[model samples]
Every structure is written in structure tokens, then in C-alpha cells.
Target: MAKIIEAFVDERGHLHTSPASAIVADIAAILGRVGDEGGLTSGVAALILEKRDAIEKAFADYDMLKSSGATIIDVSDRLRFQSHAE
Candidate 1:
């Protein structure tokens, strides 16, 4: 779960906080419920493991763009263009 967080310090030396999205919160809540009952189901664990690389890549991309000073609008525009192009 900590891996989902991608906090960083900016050039000004101020730390930026990464808040979990609603989707993440929902997933965590569901997982917590299942954990309380017992523990992670094999399927759930396998799914999380399968998605780990993609999740890590997303965090890496976000951190890279943030460190490069790219705004959300910039990423949105690029993604929009790529979607249209495809």
C-alpha cells in the first residue's frame, strides 16, 4: 500500500503529498474487509501481483512528469491526443 504513495520534495525543498484516489480508497476498503474475515484470497493476491508492474510504472511516470514540471493539463492534453490518434 505504501508503494502506491509517491511523495517527493520539489526544487524549493518542500515536500509534496500524494493523496490516494477514490478508486484506491475503495480498493483498500474492500481489501480491509476481506483481511478482517481472514486474509487475501489467492485470486486477489495474484491480481495485485500482476498489476504491480503497471502500478509502479504509473507512479514512476507521474513522478517523472512532476519532477519535470509538467502540469496535469499537459498530461491530459497528451493523453487526449494519443487517444484520438489511436
Candidate 2:
């Protein structure tokens, strides 16, 4: 059975998982609404667009994480510890 993963927003405002399609759609909608507001740095916009794929992948990996009962903190810690260990 396919598992349903819950999305979480941490204290830092970064998404715990890749934004779901619906979330991404909402963001795009909001960006469109504020498109003419100006003042956004090009680098920030480009960074967001660049991360689109990673965000999508995170959403796709959500099921895997849910099935394994892994938390973002767990993954983050493991990666950091492993990097230091090496």
C-alpha cells in the first residue's frame, strides 16, 4: 500500500519535505500575484527555481520516508555525523 506522508514546516520556515505539487502550485500562484511588486533579488528567484527539482524529488521520496518512519532531523543528523566521521 502506498503510504501518505505528512508535510511539516520547521521553525526556520524551510519545508521539511519537498513541497507537494499543490504546495508548489500555490507558491507559483502567489509569485504570479506578486510578480509586479518588484524588489526581489534575481539570485533569490533563481535559487528557488533551481531547487524546484530537489523539492519535487523530496515530495517523491516522502513515501519512502514515511514507510521507514524516518524524520528529517534523523536524516540531517546522520548526514552530519557521517560527514564528520569520514
TM-scores, in order shown? 0.34, 0.28
Q: Candidate 2, TM-score vs. the true structure? A: 0.28
Per-model lDDT:
0.58, 0.59
Among residues 3 or more apart in sequence or in different chains, the pairs in candidate 1 whose N, CA or C atoms overlap within 3 Å are none
Candidate 2: tens digits of C-alpha lDDT, residues 1-86: 99998776533455546545335444544555433564443334445666979877988898788889775566658878788789
CA RMSD of all predictions: 14.8, 15.2
Writing each residue's lDDT as its tens digit, candidate 1 over 1-86 gives 34575665433444456322333333444555455464554346446655979988999999998899865666658878788788
Total clashes for model 2: 0
Best by lDDT: 2
* Candidate 2 Cα lDDT to native: 0.59
79 Cα displacement, candidate 1 (Å): 13
Off by over 4 Å in 1: 1-45, 74-86
Looking at model 2, residue 55 earns an lDDT score of: 74
TM-score of 1: 0.34
